[model samples]
Structure formats: structure tokens, C-alpha cells
Target: LSMPKGYAMLGRGILTIEGVLTFCSPQLNFVQMLEDHAFGAMIKDFDALKEFRQIGNRLLGALSKSMDIPSEIADVLKMTVRGQTKINLGITEAAEPLNAVNKMVDKLVIGIIDAALLISSSLICTTDMSPKIFEIPVLGMMGYFAALVVGIWLLNGIIRKK
Candidate 1:
């Protein structure tokens, strides 16, 4: 027996799903790459700073034990180390807000991708003649709107850079 036209429709639906993923893949990749690079750099810097602090503390301890350094001088050095430790704590505290911002960005990007998938699936599922014609304009309008928003965001970033 021959297959019905619905079989072809099923194939088209699969293609649409693939296209949606293809469209969003680059954006997801870019976000992941940027996040990885940023986290890598931050971790590298934090580790370097931590190692330096440890080395300095060891050196100071050695000096206090071996040299005839006065107690008052040692006390001042201890206070300095305490202050630096507090500063490092403050940096960590400040990072909480940055982490929140990163989470928000992740949610926003996921929302955009979900919206795109929803729109594409809706377009694919509409089998009627009239609605399918109407959907094309709506889809085009949405595409234009998204492009406009992205352009504005890019412009804002460029302006802020200068």
C-alpha cells in the first residue's frame, strides 16, 4: 500500500525541528564558550592570588622565627595580612551579585530559545490552508522584531565599550 500525504508532513515536521536546533546551536555555543573563558580566567587569577598569599604567609612566618624581628613589627605584619584576608573576603562577597547576573543571563537566553522552538513548532503544526498563510507574516514579523532587539543590544554594548 502507498503511504498517505501525512507521511510527508511528518518528514517536514522533523525537518522543522532540525532547523530550529540548527538556528539555536550557534547562539548556545557562543554563550557556552564565553562562559567557559570567563570562568577559566577568574579561576586562574583566584588560584594565583591564593598561592601568592600562602607563599607570603610562609615567608613571614619564617622571618619571624629565624630573624630578630621585633614583636611590634610582627604584629603590624599580622594586621596587614588580616586586612588583606578581609579584602579577599570582600571580593568573594562581591562575586555573589555577578553570579546572580550570570544566572539571569542564562535564563534569558533559554527563554529566547524556548520561544523560538515554540514558534517554529506552532508553524509546523498548523495544517490548515488559511492559517498557514497567516502564520508566515506573523513569523516574519517576529523574526524582524528579534533582529531589531538584538541590533539594539549590540549597539548598546558597543556604545558602552567606548
Candidate 2:
């Protein structure tokens, strides 16, 4: 496809995705919290969306290659392609807000841990301890940060699991 045509297609896809995200934003959080069985159903829906995208892409490619195709026929084909593309785009757009929410939740969890660390550090400082034992607080802080990183990684894995 020509660059202009491809960009136009992308623009339409983005707009459609934006509309879908707006429409579904309210329910996104609830959907994320679903049990594994229900989440499997959601994954099926995502797979269907991916299939629609693939079909749309194939239709567009086929239409582009057939020079002898009538304009009327081409128009119909383009419409179908764009429609399917929009559905796929919408699904992708809907996922963005959910990702943002997950990041926010992860940050909140980390913040709570930080608060606890601060409280514990203050309590530890009040005690008279050997210099060697003082190393424990520094190590504890390092371990807590390491745990934060690992926890976020695991959470992302859980979220992305099929």
C-alpha cells in the first residue's frame, strides 16, 4: 500500500480504538479482577479480535493486489476491511487503560511497602545496636526494593498469562 493510504488506515484504526476505549473504560477495572475461568472467556474475545484484525489485513492486501477489481467491489471490500480493523483497534485501545490501572496498582503496593519500611527504620534507629548490626537496616531496604521489582514483574506475568 502507498504510504498515504497506510497512514489513513492507521488514523481510522486509532480513532476507532479511541472510541472503544471510551465506551469500555468504566468496566475495565472490574474485568481485570475476574477469576481465571472468566478471564479465559475474555482471552477468547481477544483472540476473536485478533482474528478480525488478521482477516481485515488479508482483505486489504488482496484488494490492493487485484488491479482489475471494479471500484464498486473495491469500495465494499474496503468497508469490510475497515470495519474489522476498527474492532481489532478497539480491543487494543481498551487494553491501554487497563495497563495503566495495573501500573497504578503496582505503584500503590510499592508505596505501602515504602511506608512500612520508613516506620520500621525509625523503630530500628531508636535501639542501640553494634555497627555490624546497623548493616541489617541497609540490607533490609535493599531487599525490600528488590522485592518490589520482583513483585511487579510477577504481577505483570500474572496479568499477561493466558
Candidate 3:
């Protein structure tokens, strides 16, 4: 597809994802949108407001990307007003990072549950293990595994922090 047309499609998709994010967790997603000024005004907590400002700065840096919105490839998007073009491009470009963030959030929820289960199973198996069962112990094994995961995640967090 042409660059402009592709951008239009991507822009609409971004807005759709934004709507979904708002529906799922409005508070967390308040600053996700490129032009999410309303969220900034709504937050009352000082920490939340500060976080929103940081998000705003990140978005401002990203929005500097001047993308070409797709026009005449035959679609509903080509009809967007010139004034809304920047918002459209900003939203579309932001969609990628937003989508990745959403995916990571989902994975984290699932991972937490899974890790808990593994740790629980390990504890149960180790606590209940008899001398007859000479295999490696359970709880400690799971603990090691969980610790490794946490370590990796923490390392990644540090990398991102840098």
C-alpha cells in the first residue's frame, strides 16, 4: 500500500486500540493517547500528575515524527480534515508502542499467576516429598526458576530505565 494510505489505515487502527485501552483501564491508559490532554487535567494526585507529565514528554518526542497520512487509496480515512491530520498521525505512530505495552501488561498478569502456581506446586511437592522419591526437590526448584524469571525481568527493567 502507498505510504499515505497505509498511514490512514494505521491511524484508524491506533484510535481503535486507544478506545480499547480506555475501556479496559482508563486510569492506566489516560496518558497513552498522543493528545491526551483531558487526562492530564483530570488527574489530581501529585504523583499521577508527575507520571502523566513524563508520559507527555515521551509522546511529544515521538509525535515529532511527521508521518504522511494515506489519502486516495479509496477508504474512509482519506476524508479526514487537515486539522486532524497530526493527531491522526500521532495516534497511528503511537499505536505500535502502545500495543507493545498492552501486550507486556497482559503477559505480566499471566506470568504472575503462572509463577505463583509454579511456586505453590514446588512447595507442595517438596513439603510432601518422602525419602522414596529421590528426584530433585520441588519447592526449591520452583523457587530457583521463579527467581530466575524475576531476575531477568528486573534486568530488563533496569535496561529500560537506562
Candidate 4:
């Protein structure tokens, strides 16, 4: 039989060209390259096509306006557009209290650690250890400062939450 010059051959040729374009420019979409160069060149009446699209849109709009759309159908269309928004709102609301509780628990844990650090640092300061900063143990002083900073940060976070 003669070489097939049907849709199968046409589709194969299109796929081959698209694959080559994709290989050459991995960053760009193959279909877009075909549209821009191959298919774009083939479109000799883009203006006519655009005009036809506008006319089709106008006709559809007119038909829709003339038709009586039921409330249930209208609601379904609205739901399609706003479905994601509804889902997002539900998730955010669900996570809101959990986020607050998580932060509260975190602050409680940090507060406990800070209290332990303060007690240990004070005990260290009482000892006559070497490397003293104005008769106070340097390590103890550093620990006290760190605990104070962390306490202040925790307090700031609590205040901001309120």
C-alpha cells in the first residue's frame, strides 16, 4: 500500500516536531513553540478567527440572557468558581485554634526551660569560680542573660498573640 498520509501520519509528524522543539528548548513548552512558529504561520486569518470568536461569544451571551436559569443551576455555577475558597476558609478556621494552642504549649515549654536556666545560673553565681565578671561567674552571667532574652522573647510573642 502507498505511504499513509492520514491523521496517524500527521499526528506522528506533529509529535516528532514537538519533541525536537522540546529537546532544543527544555525550558519552553513544546505546544507553545508549535503554536508560535508552526501553527501560528499556518493561521492566515487570525483577525477573521478573532472576529468569529467575538461573534460566537456574543451569541452565547444573548442566548443565556434569553434563557431562564434556575436558582439551583446558578448556585451550582457559583459553587464551581468558589469551591476552593470555601475549602480554604474551612481549613484556616479549623487550624486557627490549633495554631494558638501550639504556640501556647511552646511558650509553656520555653518558660519551664527558662526557669530552670535562671535557677542553675543563680546557683553557679553563688560559687567562687574562676573567670569572674565583677566577682560573678562568667558562665553564670551568660546563662542568666540568655534566659532573660528568651523570657523577653516569649513575653513579646504572648503579648502579640493577645
Candidate 5:
């Protein structure tokens, strides 16, 4: 998909290259938008700082559970071993694989974006949809429920040996 300026979508075909998670590098404009908008910045800043600590905890949890990778990574080898376990385990298990897992550093990053995208698109499609519906005051957060279902499926797949 070509953009109005010059940017284009990265690829079309399902990538067969194992361990090379094939997400298109997130466009710079997305970060630019986050930086430019006050609400966006505040939302991202607050959420990311919160998620950052949670991510550290999760990483430690994963490291403790890993067998093949050394938990105590040396400084030099740190970058090399950083994601070896997740990619190996994640792609084989996670439903969306590359886009949903590896490229996303924090769970909240994907969660927030996925929810935002869903709400935004839903709003666009149904202009009459109250913002409350996205917030799910009446429908009781079906979006959140859907996300929970997907998240459960992903975690269940990862935690279980197939």
C-alpha cells in the first residue's frame, strides 16, 4: 500500500523466514503523531511508564522459566540472547505471530494499539457509535472482552506445549 507522500507497505506474501519477524518497521510518523499531540503524548507517556515496569517483571519471569537461554546474561552477549526464547516460543504459538508478538516490546503497546485501532475503525464505520460504546459502558466492554479472549488464547497457546 502506497501512501500519499511516498511510503509503501513492506511486503505482501506470508513470510516463511523463521526467526525473522516480518512486521514492517513502524512508521516514524506514528511516533511523530504521538509527540505532536498533547493527549496522545500524555496517554502514551503515562501508559508506557506504567507498562515499562510491568515489562521488566514479565521479562524476568520469562528468563526464570527459560531452559535453553542463560538467565544470567553477560553484558556482551546480552543483545544477542535478548529475544532468542520469545521468538522461538512465540511464533510457534501466538496466533498473529510476527506482528502481534516480537515487534511489540510491551504487552500494553500491542494491547493499547489494538484497542485503539478497533475503536477508531468502529467509530469511523459507525459515526453514530457513542464514544461510551468504545469505552463499553452499555455493551459492557465487548472490545475488552474480545481482547481478553484473544489474549487468553495466545497465553494459553504459549504456556501449553503443543
Candidate 6:
């Protein structure tokens, strides 16, 4: 059969595995998107569950204490009633080292300045003002050069630090 317009030669047959996989590849992206959405919802649910467990522990402990039980025994009784378990609050990832943080902040600031210079230079180049270098404004050219220098400096710093 002739390949349909806009269909690649390898993707023209419904019966071929390659054709089916090629057609289905776009749908595979939706799976990742759905997984991400589901994971975020799961995290919210976990946080709510953690909060619920904490409230339950507090309420149970208060009730047990009000019954005139000794504080130590009330604690034990609370544990037993709650299935003798520990509730983990949440996962904690180790923080970046201070040096890394500082370096990131520095790079971020420099990157912003570089982007600004690039945008401003592009705008300046579009203006009718003269003192042109190859028909481009010299001021804009200077800005572009400055941005290139900043970019190189940023890269140099990153490489040296590593």
C-alpha cells in the first residue's frame, strides 16, 4: 500500500509493530503526565494522613490522662491503643552545602544579568541609531560582547569550582 501523505514510510501500516508503536508513542507521554499528577495527589494525601495520625495520638493521650491513669502508664496505653507504631512525618532530603548554595545564587544572578544584556542588545540592534558596526549598532554590539564575556566568566567559574 502507498504511504499516506505526512506518514513516514516506516509508520504506514496498522498491522506492523513499528507502525503501532510509532502511532502510540504520543500516548505514552500522557502516562508520564498522569503519573506525575497522581504522585502529587498521593503526597498531599500522605501529608493529610500524617496530620490525622498526630491529632489522633494527641486526642487519645488526653483521654487516657483524664481517666486518672499514671502519666507513664497512660503513654504506654496510648501506644498500645494506637497499634504500637511510630508515624514518620515525611521524607527529608539533605540540603545543599553552603558553598553550593552560594555558588548557585551567584550563577543565578549572573545568568539573569547575561539574559538582560542579550535582550537589550537585540532591541538596540533593531533601532535606527547609527555609529554602526557592519550595519548593526555599535552599542548593541558592545552589549552582546559584554553578555558573551559574562557567559564565559560564568562557565569558567563553574568549571574551576568543579
Best by lDDT: 4
Candidate 2 runs further than 4 Å off: 1-93, 132-162
Q: Model 4 lDDT vs. the true structure?
A: 0.84
lDDT of each: 0.66, 0.67, 0.65, 0.84, 0.55, 0.82
Q: Which residue pairs clash in candidate 4?
A: none
- Put down candidate 1 lDDT per residue, 1-118, tens digits, no spaces: 7779999897787667666766977444544555699899888778777789999999999988877658767877898878843343345577789987886686578567656755
lDDT of 3 by residue, 1-162 (tens): 457988899788877887888899777553355556756666643587678999999888776652322334323454454333334334557878998898778767766875776677566666646432357555556566776777577557757856
Q: Sort the predicted structures by TM-score, highest score first.
A: 6, 4, 3, 2, 1, 5
Q: Which candidate number has the best TM-score? A: 6
Clashing pairs in 3: 4-70, 5-70, 122-139
For model 1, what is the alpha-carbon lDDT of residue 64?
A: 81
TM-score of each: 0.23, 0.26, 0.28, 0.41, 0.20, 0.42
Please report how far candidate 2 places residue 31 from its true position, in Å.
Answer: 50
Write down the worst ten-residue block by lDDT for model 2. Answer: 26-35
Once fitted onto the true fold, the runs of candidate 1 whose alpha carbons sit more than 4 angstroms away are 1-91, 96-136, 158-162
By lDDT rank, best first, the candidates go 4, 6, 2, 1, 3, 5
lDDT string, candidate 6, 1-162, tens digits = 876665774344423654455587844554455569989998877877779999999999999887776777888889989899577785456355766788799899999999999999999999988999899999999999999999999999889978
Angstrom error of the Cα, residue 10, model 6: value is 65
RMSD of 4: 14.9
Q: Which digits, one per residue and each the tens of the lDDT, describe model 5 over residues 1-162?
A: 646432222222212221133344433344344347977667666876678999999998987778545644553377566754433343465666756666445555656766775575555544444556534443435555666676775566556734
lDDT, candidate 2, 11-70, per-residue tens: 787667666766888554332343566878877778777789999999999978786568
In candidate 1, the residue pairs with backbone N, CA or C atoms under 3 Å apart (3 or more residues apart, or in different chains) clash, namely none
Error of 6 at 42 (Å): 42
lDDT for 159 in candidate 5 is 65
